[model samples]
Target: MSLIKKTFKTIDELKKHLKTHAPTFYYSSQTSTVIPYDKIADFFKNKEMTLGDLSQLPCSMELTPTQNLIVKGAISWKDAKDFLRSKKRNIMTSPTEELALISAGAATSATGERCFHFGNLRSQIISLTYLNFDGNEVKLNQDIALKNTSNEVKKYQKDYAQYDIFKNAPFPRLETQTDLMIGTEGQLGIITEIEIKTTDDFPVNHLFILLPKWEVDSKAHLEIINKVQKFRNMVILCELIDANSFEYLPKADRPNKEMDAIFFEIKTQSFNDFYEQFVLNLEYIDQDHVFELAATKFHNIRASIPRAVFEKNSQMGVVKKGTDVQVSVSQFETLLKIYQNFTKLGIKYNLFGHFGDAHLHFNFMPLPNQVELCHEQLELLYGHVLKLNASPFAEHGIGIIKQKYIPAFWNQNTFKVFKQLKDEHDPYKQFFPQGFMSLEDHS
Candidate 1:
C-alpha cells in the first residue's frame, strides 16, 4: 500500500503502519524516551533491522502575498527558515522552533520579543488542520468566536473535575480547542498543516559584554539584569555564555580565560534611545569601552559552543545531556548559585541560553564514566528549579526524555486534567506515544 494514501481504519492499523514504515518512531531502550532522529546512521543502528530506505516525507509550502506561510507539518524548520530568508522575511523563532512545530504542532521561543504577539506561537497561527485519533479530519480557525452558554459551562465543569486548579491561574480565560492542541506535544492529534505570519527582515545591532568570573555571583550582575529588563523593549535577544562554554569555541573566537560573556541583539532603529536610557548606567563596563559585532557573526559565535560540546561528546562515545530550566527573573542569583555548586562538584558542564527570559540550557558534556554523575546533578538542579517555582522544561516541551519530570511540575489534579484531555482526543494513545507522559501503565 502507498503510505501517503493509506487511510487507517483502526488504531491498530495506524500502529502497524508506523512500526513497519516509520520504525524510528519508538523510544530508546537506554533512556526509555524518543529523541530527534538527526542522523540516518543512528536511525538504522537503533532499529537493528532495515526493511527499506527511509525516505523524506512529502510536504508543501506556500507563501502568500501578505508574507504568511502555509506549510505542511512534515517540513523541517531549517527549510522553513530558508524559505523565509529567500523572501527577505523572518519569524523571530527559537532555534528549536522547527523541531517542535513539525513533531508537536506547537512550540515556544525566547524570540517572543520580536514577534507581533510577543512570543506566543498560538497568536501567530492563523489556522490548523489535523487528523484526529479516530481517523477523522478536523480544521480549526484561530479567530473563531466561542460561545459560553450555560450548557457549555456546565459541560466544562463536569468534564474538568479539577477546575479549581486553574481558578487562580494568571490567565483565567478559557482556552479554545485550538489553543489546547498547540502545545499538547502531538497527544491530541496529528498536525497536517499550519498557517504562520511572518515579519519583514530588519538589521540588528549586536553588543557583547564580557564579565569577569567574580561578577557572575555578585550584585553587579543583578544590576545589569535590572538594566536590561528596564530597556527590554529595545533588545531583541539577551544571552549569557559561561566561561566553560568558551572551551568549545575556536581559539580565535574564545574570550579571556577567566571571563564569561553576555550577547545582546537590539533592533538598530532604537539603538541610540537604548544607549541613552540604559547603556550609560551599566557600571560593569568602563565609559569609554565599547564592543560590537555583526549580528550574524555574534549569533554564529554563540552557536559554535553547543556544536563543539556535542562533537566532543560524540568523539568520547558518551551521550550529551542537558536541562532547559527557567526561573523567575528575580531568582537569577539563585540560579547562578545552583550553577556554581555544580561547578564546585567537579562536574564538566557549560551554561548558556536566553537570559532575557531567565531560561538557560545547562549542558553537561560528561565523559563516558561520568554519565551517572551528570544525571545526579540534573536531579539536584531540577529540585532547586521547583523550589523557586520555576519550570524544568520551558521552551522545550516534555518529550520522552523529560516525561519523568511531568509529575514533579504538575500537581495530581493538573495531571488528571492532562490525562483526561489526552483520553478525549487520543483514547488509544496512538499519536506520539509517551511523548509528554508515559502511557505504559494505561496501555
Candidate 2:
C-alpha cells in the first residue's frame, strides 16, 4: 500500500501557506527550477520610484539570508527583480534547508525548461588564474540562453557532462570529467558563479564521430572504462547526472537523434592539439571493433559523446519521465545488458548518459505518454536495474518524481527507519510535507 497520497491541497492553499508562514526552507531549495528557463530575460529596471500592483500582491514577503545571499552581491536591485522573473535558472539553487523556514510561496508540479536562460548582468563569472603561470588563459563569460544565438557561446559553451585532457605537447596520457549537478525542479534555484582551470585560449574544435550503434555481443570496453578510472584521479569537479526527462525533448529541439550517446568533456591548448593527442593515444581507437580484445588493455582511456549530442539533451530538460527510482554507482554494466535487451524488444530509447559511474541515462520512446503507462514501463526497467543490485535513485534524490519507486530500491525495514527520522525533523509535517514522499517514513 502506498503510504503517501497527494494532500489534495488547492493551489490557493499552497500559495497562502507560502505567503503567510513562508516555508522558504524546504520547497525553495531543490524544486524551484520546475519553472522558467525561457529565453525571457527581464521585466522592468530603473532607479525612478516605481509602483507595483500593491493592493493584493503586496511585497509582504521577506527573503531569508540564503535566498537573499546572492540577491544583493550578485545582482543589483533592478537585476534582482530581473533574476526573479525566471526565479528558476543558474548554478546551485537556493538550498532547501532555507525554503522550509518560510511559509512556502508558490509551488508547482512540473519541470523547468532550460532554454539556457542564464545571464550575468545580474551575475558575474570569473576563472582561476594560478600564480605558477599557466599557458594561454581564456577569460570569457557570455550570457547563456536556450538557443545558440549570440557569438559569445565560446564564453559559455560547457562540455557535455564529461570530457578528456592530455598533459603536455606529446600528450601521452588523457584526463576527462563527467557531470552530475543537481537541480531544483520547481523551487527557485540559480547558479551565480562557477570556476574552472584552463591553460590558454584557442578555438575548441570537435569531431562529431558517429559510430554504428551495434550491440556488443561480448563484454568489451570494460578495460577502457577502467582506464578512465585512473585518469579520473586527476579530475577536478566531475559528476554524473542521470534524469529520465531527456526522453521528453521535442524532436525539433534535439540536436542529434541518430545515436544513443553519452555526454563528456575534454580540454586542450588548441583544437588541433587536442585532436592530435586524442589520435596518438588510441586507447579507444577500435572500440567499435568488438572481437573480445583482452579487457586488460589500456592504462589511460577517455570516453565521451559529442557537444551537438549534448546541447539537445540539455534542452530536453531535467525532470524524470515517470516514477522511476535512481540506482547506486556500481551495477552499471549489468544494467546496460538488460537495457540493451529491452531496446532490442522495440523499447526504443536514447542512451546518452554518464558511464563514469552507474548513474547512466536512457530516453525511452514516448509512444504511450500516459504517466501510468510510462511508470509501468519504468517498473519493468527499474526492476531489472534493482534485480542486479542497482538503485534507480542514483544521483537525483527522492522527490515526487520517484515516490512510486521507493519500494524498488529499499526493503520495508529500511523504509521504517527513514519515517522515524522524518517524524523527528518536522513533527508538524509543515516542511516539504508529503511532496517528496519520504522513503524514511513507512507510516
Candidate with the greatest TM-score versus the true structure: 1
Instruction: Write model 1 residue lDDT over 35-117, tens digit each, in one string.
Output: 43334344335333322211133567888987888887356556777788888987655452333333243422122223311
Per-model C-alpha RMSD: 6.5, 17.5
What TM-score quantifies how close candidate 1 is to the native fold?
Answer: 0.77
Each candidate's lDDT (Cα)?
A: 0.58, 0.30
- Tens digit per residue, CA lDDT, model 2, 252-306: 5333344322222333233344334433354544534221111111101111222
TM-score of each model, paired residue for residue: 0.77, 0.44
Worst 10 residues of 1 by lDDT: 164-173
Q: Clash pairs of candidate 1?
A: 112-119
Q: What are the per-model numbers of colliding residue pairs?
A: 1, 60
